[model samples]
Target: MPIEIHQSDPQSYAVAADFLNVADVEVVSLQHEFGIFGGNAGDHILELVQRLRTPLVTTLHTVLAAPDEAQRRVMNALIRSSARLVVMAEKGRQILQTVYEVPNEQIAVIPHGVPDRPFLDPAMAKHDLGLADRTLLMTFGLLGPGKGIETAIHALPALVRNHPKLIYMVVGATHPNLVRHEGERYRDSLVALAADLGVSDHVLFVDEYLSIEDLLKYLTACDIYVSPYPNAAQITSGTLAYAVALGKAVVSTPFWHAQELLSDGCGMLFSFGEADALSTAVAQLIEDDSLRSAMRTRAYARGREMVWPSVAEQYLDVFSKVRFERRSAGAMVIPFPASVGEHDRLPPVSTTHLASLTDGVGLVQHTKFAVPDRRHGYCLDDNARALLVMSELAGLVPLTPQEDQMTLT
Candidate 1:
């Protein structure tokens, strides 16, 4: 179905409600940011969610560890109004459960999506980027306070001491929100820090926003990717996710998302805002070829689950589940097939079909020609049909005494 765009000013409640009403959307899907909830804007979203008759599915961008009263109220109300809530990480789901007391069933874990790209060797990628001699370390995002780019810069002197050919590339403009408020103070601070540390020559800042192709090029060229974000509660990091997906050896601060993704040899984690720890983590990967290769392999394997196609399928699954639940909630009948009764008058069906259709679990839902197709996965409807057929066959097959007792029990 084609979706229509309905724009509204979030700061104004009447405007938002008017746009929502005009759309008459089946599902009110929201991409929420907790920071936007600081003013009365949060209430506007909550109000819209409540007033709209449509089902709601919210993809939460920021799941705060500590929420104040208004924040909690808004988040709780959003959860109550939404048919399902989508979070990018298991840690985000856990926080919602423990902190907001949201029901487990209402929450869905869909990883932040990454573009599918063929894995390329960093050396080959670097040759293309004209940085074949440099061991590149990078972090790219719209920069602002709390990104902890300063920590990465501070760590550069030590990293440069061990590997003089290392270059730390900070690829992004100052975040628009931060620029609006602080106007490059954070970027200037980072530049000053680099200069003071005498590693100014080694740090490269590509101060332009990258297109997806450009971003992927830079990501493919890096020896190691570093996310030095300072916030422990931070739930999503697209930059880190991309690097991990591309199989770059990642060293990151222990933010919620990083801790979850980088565990068990996938990548290394250091304490938040600890430049020394960042340096050591990077040094370990730099010094050991085998260890870095292993981490890269593990990172690549784990990232396969989060590629765009897989993530899109997961989103579709959630949408299907929510749509089914909404439609079935008011339904009175189970809607079984009418042809089921005709099986009695016709000659008995051969078990050959059933035998071919059976898997270790149960009967499969789909078929390719005469053969079972398991690619679409199992369905309860098909399994239910199998159970009904088995029950009818029970009369002809006499059960032994022990078998009879087990069946009864």
Candidate 2:
């Protein structure tokens, strides 16, 4: 099977790769945030993707405001070139439609996926993880001020004093590149806040990034998963997805996906930016064991229907339709192996470049709260592609030779 793709970032590719079942994938170097950010786009990348013989089906990862004119120009061209726009939530699609003027008909909102886990059997998980005796409340993600760890921390003292047996586990550290964005300052701040709250002993902080297995182990042991994030749109929450998959009761301030998923019975929501409200809702769930039980049951059922397999189908369907329309309208079709052999070019970014978006990224804001997610260790999306090249040289992800067949319509 052949589904030719040319993505700009590695983290996005990693999530996208799981849904695709194919042997030959041609990656253009656009995914370079972590690989090698020269503070600019590389010509090898442009030549790699621009020469595509088949129309590319791309997912616009963000709406940036950058100073790099070249990046902006490329982004503009790329959006126009895509067969269809694929996003994880409707808000992302709306951003494209209202802000970028991407026609509403051309976008599809397919939320991210959560892998199957031992969520349905809490008793067995508790026994396996030795959490049978304690009430485990957990929150996992890149630890930054925007993540609202402080809010959860403040809420924790309330939780623990009422039920002293509770424990909260925070899982991963911020991305290495984000260190440029805001370093260990956020992590250090959380540590200090916990100490001041005097819940230092009760709160477990693991500084190293956790593997998926390590993450799952904690999920299995958790009774409640919280997303105290001030900004919801920083990115969709895999933490939330994982918790929902296992059916753990979720207590979160309102975020886009949270609002959508919470109502389905897997979790509950509190008003965003209000710590007292956040605290009260969390307290309610902890004291009421029956509600937690019901939320868990619904979450598992939702996960079966919305996880990667189903989400991938929606993507595939959108790509098929959009590609058909473009082809019908005489959009040139790029064949496999759109050569990277000779082209040396850099399409200038917009006067308003996107990479600059980090300056005032509309944080997804709970009060003045102070952040794949895999530890593949790429600096930005770029680092992953470089690693891909290295892996092929080292034979990490070995290719099994096979033929690919594509039908335009």
The candidate scoring highest on TM-score is 1
Task: Score candidate 1 by lDDT.
Answer: 0.83
TM for every model, in the order presented, reads: 0.78, 0.65
Residues 1-409 of candidate 2: C-alpha lDDT, one tens digit per residue: 2333344544433433443324243322122221332224422234334445455666544444322676666555666656556666666776676656788776667777777664555556666866677777788877666778777888877777788878787888776867887777777877898999899977888677888887887788787888887865633566787788777888887877687777766677776577677668777887887887787788788777667788768767776675566454656777777547455444432312112221222212122212122222224444344334434433433332210000000
Error of 2 at 229 (Å): 1.1
Please give the distance, in angstroms, between residue 145's alpha carbon in candidate 1 and its true position after superposition.
1.3
> Tens digits of per-residue lDDT for model 1 on 1-409?
4333233444454455456767755566788885554345366566567776667789999887788787777887888888999999999999989988889999999999998887778998888988999999999988887888888998988889979999999998888988999898888988898999999989999899889999899999999999988888889888889999999999998888999999988999999888999999999999999999999999998899999999989988888888778874668756776675766465544566766777666767899988888898788887787676655656656545533332332
Position 87, candidate 1: lDDT: 96
Full-model lDDT for every candidate: 0.83, 0.62
Instruction: Determine which window of 10 residues in candidate 2 has minimal summed lDDT.
Output: 400-409
TM-score of 2: 0.65
What is the alpha-carbon lDDT of model 2 when measured against the actual structure? 0.62
